[model samples]
Target: MPDLSSFPRHSWLRALRQGLSSIESQSLGYTSPKGLPDARTAVSDYLRRTRGVLADPQRVVLCSGATQAIALLAHVLRNRSVAMEDPGFWLHRMVFRHHGIEPLPIPVDDDGLDVTALANTTASTVLTTPAHQSPTGIVLSPARRTALLEWARAGNLVIEDDYDAEYRYDRAPVGALHALAPDRVIYLGSVSKTLAPGLRLGWMVLPPDLVRPVVSAKSLADTGSSVMDQLAFAALLRSGDYDRHLRLMRRRYLARRNYLLHALREYLPDATVLGAAAGVHLTVRLPDDCDIEDIVRRAASRRVRIDPLSWCYTEPDCAPPGLILGYANLTESQIDTGVRAIAAAVGHSSQVVPDINGKVAPDSGP
Candidate 1:
């Protein structure tokens, strides 16, 4: 079994210190249904300056996290079909199921989501990650962006989940979709990826028509997120600590990414690594002979945690076979040892299923 543990970091300590060191703290009480004003204002300013979201403090609905935002939107936009990238974050698909909304698995290529295909569907709402797309790390083509916005203008609600837009290695990250069509795109983001996942802080920039309904859903969900944390986040953002953390994280993840690639080439050269363009995790496709499920089990048995490629799919989708390697939690030494263990566990053996569906010749081309 491969020893594939996650990347490790200490971002939460910084935020915790910041939170604990507040000069005068308020009571831990129910937050405003729309979220604390300062938090919303902070997020609005961050999006404008960082993500280029054309939004006001009034439009930012702070939620428990991006997942909560998805659920809230699913509830508010009932009966309206929602479309998402097929090999997307599986939790998003589950949220739609729980809310009685159909999560249409729209196909994603190297160019990003097939916006034309999404437009051809009967969905009323579309969920997208335009900046450093998840699972496949491909930037959405500019043509697709224009087409999707045009479709949204023609009467489709585009829920933009700017989940992991902060880290970009190749070039400066692209601007937000809401900046171009604020009236049609509902922008969502969270500190889960930036500060830490434990914080559970995320915000949504709802369309004018969605503001009330989304807020109502949020009010019912949990009466809003932690007020203290929200205020603390606002302080962090206003103080420029949040952006500083992002820049710091980008440098760290970039190094980890380089290490993983080097280790793979030196260790598992037969493996194909994709989606290294950006984001916290990269996808590495295994040869067809690899028993993905068995590989996961073996990795776990070896005391390493790895997410299987198939785990992200509810329905069969066009995702190549690979594991989503999150290098945000493990150190380089751990990564090296883990990948070597993975190579050992996988052994020089390919567990190819006896079918042409997923064939991986031991010596294959990229």
Candidate 2:
């Protein structure tokens, strides 16, 4: 979830009001299943200008969210093995499995997804978060980017989930992988991080060849997304309010991230923080001897909610002991308190907390 407190409530209200007022009486009926054309145009322009994605409105397929977008892809590309990052978004794996498309877990490292290892997989369709990998904030290296593109050109499809690419703090913004090989890459993104996940608004900038199939799949899934909602979002994008909201959020999130980093340095001096330069969450690698479940339990007892990094892994046993701490929803003081609680939890673990879907053991407490 994004920071709801920072949402541009007034701007969204203004845009939505204008959108509703501008809806012509004659255009009240159902529109194209591809979603509002104006919305697509707005998104295309925004993506190109900000993320360097080369998209045309004709190729943008609007869906409920990235989840629905991937579901549509699974439906259209059924029976195909979709290679996803091993310790990737677990929800994606479940979505693919539910849709009857088994996802092949590909290993990811400091350089993002191991393109060399991915090349060895029989799966031709690969889903990757190349910009800022989920759970692990590793950006794909330039050389590996080239190799991935080449591989995609060799009759493979790269599904680029450009999620939360707008929140980089320390370095220059990394361009979307779709910009490199638009023809072979399917770019998917949503306003879930920027605006709100409740909106369920997202898009897929598809290859020219995949547009029709995806559009048809979208049509079958739902007649179309809410026309009024699309119109309001289009207004938000065209009026530049969405970009403004991003700017405000970037500053706020950066502060929270810095405070969290400083707190970690002070409280958990032994822990290693990963992916702190970007994204809303940071992964903290704990000492191997520490029981993650026990620590999580202790933190929970102190009213500090921390997610176990092991939950994202397909092979949790093989993954390093760590916690995925999201600072986006917490205040600076809260983050400090949370880190202190976690540090205490780490320091006092005397028994192994049994993994209950990455939850702390019921008996374990502060």
Candidate 3:
């Protein structure tokens, strides 16, 4: 989730007004299932300029957020199961299952998805977040990136979920894997994290061969996404307001991330933080004796909502005790309060908290 408090309402309104005034009356009717030409072109330009994605407007299919995009792919590629990062986004796995596409869990390590483990899977399609692995927040190492692409070249498809690539604090964002081999990679991205999820705006830059089937699947899904919304987003992209808003939010989120890190050090000194380099949330690895369920329940009692790390895994028992804390939606004081509450919840643990020495400790267990 993004900082909803700082949503560019005025900018969006201006874009909406411009979109309505400039849109053709003919466009109000059923447009192409691929999406409005302007929207697709705008997305293509933005992605090409920022993420190094090899995007063609003709190959870009806009949908109602990444959720719809995933569903469409599952429908088009339902012949076989898809390989997913073991501690990946849980909701995506559910979406695949809903569309009758079983997801094969592939282990993720500090270097990102284990390409070796993935190579062993029978699934032809693998969904990955190379920029910043979901929940874990580790960037895919150069070696792993090459290995994964090699695997894709061997008659496989890579679903690159460019998740949380916009808010990198430590360095410039990594380039999209799609640029290396566009035909073998299906790039997924949305304003859900940057703008707002309610907009339900997302896009897919598909392989030439997959484009027609995906467009067909999208048509069967909803006849295409909302045209007005798409046009509005196009206006935002064209006018440069979207980039300005991102610059502003990046500063804000960076501040919040820093404060959260400080709060963790001060209040929850025993906990180890991971994935703070990018994304709106960070993972805090708790002591071994800390019961994650009990900590989550106790934190909820304090009116602090926190997601246990185990919830992101396909098999909960395999996940280590930790918490996924989001700071994008909370103020500095709220973050401090929330961290204190979580610290209280974790107070029952008797295991020693090792000094992380200003580095994220590597996980020793699966």
Candidate 4:
């Protein structure tokens, strides 16, 4: 839910119209597997300027979305084990599993993915969300970043997921890990966050060695992505509309994030808030004794949909309980209402809570 409410409808319509008008006759028939040249160039330039990722247009492969980018990698890198953060994105693990590649889980702490632990694993590849780590929102520290790169250079490969790197609040934006060692890092990003997920547009900046195989995989995946959308995106990028949209949404999301934080402080003050400085979602660490399933049921009963952080783990029973609250798509009032509901669900509020979904029984720590 990447703030679709604030999507620039008028600007996109304008750009789309312009893009369609400018589309050459030949472009309508068939396009390169590497994607529309205009879109690729625009994406490369935008990434280089914003994320400090030195990407060449030729090396950029536009895919259906980031999921497809990962799938393409899975297809190309078959028979190899990939290490992912223990409490990382669940879909990454599922996608790898679908491709017969079982991912080794490396525990992540406040410092981001434990690179030292990753070094000890026999896995040669690691997929990481370093910019603002998914769910945890912990930025990879400078020391860990260097160590991770050193590990990557030592006959290892890194898949950098720059998922929600655009919306940072507290600190200066951290440059993409690809910048440190482009040869070892495969950078992945998607318009799914900035634009609409329905558009299903994404790009990957691959290492030179990977350009051909991934492109071949993509060619077999769908021939190519929708050409019309790519053209419109290129136009949006070229006309400065995309940057303007991001800037506008950044301020709006920051406000929504702040409101949620303030509400949480007022209500669920005991719950620890993580990764609130950036990204569309925030992770709330609950007491270890709390039953996450019961809380989720209670939240659902109240019409508030909150995701359980435990789902991201390979073994849910062993993981600490937390909630991944997405604030970008909800209004301030809705956020307040949702937090109040969660507080009530978790017994944080003094109000006599309803017997909703039966009460959550406490558990002694293992």
Best by lDDT: 3
Candidate 1 per-residue lDDT, tens place, 1-366, comes to 111232123433455466556634543466568987766887888888877788789888988889999989888888787889867888898888887876887888888999878978888788988887777787889999999899999888999988678878878788888999998999988877776677788888988888999888888878878876776777777767666766767888889889988888877778888778778788888887776766677677768888877766656444456888877778898787777656654552453221122222352321
RMSD per candidate (Å) reads 5.5, 4.4, 4.8, 3.9
- Candidate 3 lDDT over 11-102, as tens digits, reads 88999999999899999999999999999999999999999998999999999888888888989989966899999898999999998877
Q: lDDT of each structure?
A: 0.76, 0.86, 0.90, 0.88
Q: After aligning candidate 1 to the native by TM-score, how far in Å is the CA of 200 from where it should be?
A: 0.8
* Per-prediction TM-score to the true structure, in the order listed: 0.88, 0.94, 0.95, 0.94
Error of 4 at 147 (Å): 0.7
Ranking by lDDT: 3, 4, 2, 1
Off by over 4 Å in 2: 350-366
Q: Give the range of the ten consecutive residues with the poorest summed lDDT in model 3.
A: 351-360
Error of 3 at 143 (Å): 0.4
**What clash count goes with each model?**
9, 1, 0, 0
- Give the range where candidate 2 is weakest over 10 consecutive residues by summed lDDT: 351-360
Please give, for residues 83-133, the per-residue lDDT of candidate 4 as tens digits.
Answer: 899898989889999999889999999899998899888999999999989
Give lDDT tens digits, candidate 2, residues 1-366: 679877788988888898889777655577778887788898999999999999999999899999999899999889677889989988888899899877888898888889999899899999999888997898989888999999999999999998779999999999998888899999999988988888899999999989999988888888789887788899998998888888989999999999998888777767899998899999899888988888899899989888888888888877889999999989987887788778768766844332312233443553
Ranking by TM-score: 3, 4, 2, 1
CA lDDT for candidate 1: 0.76
206: Cα error in model 3, Å? 0.3
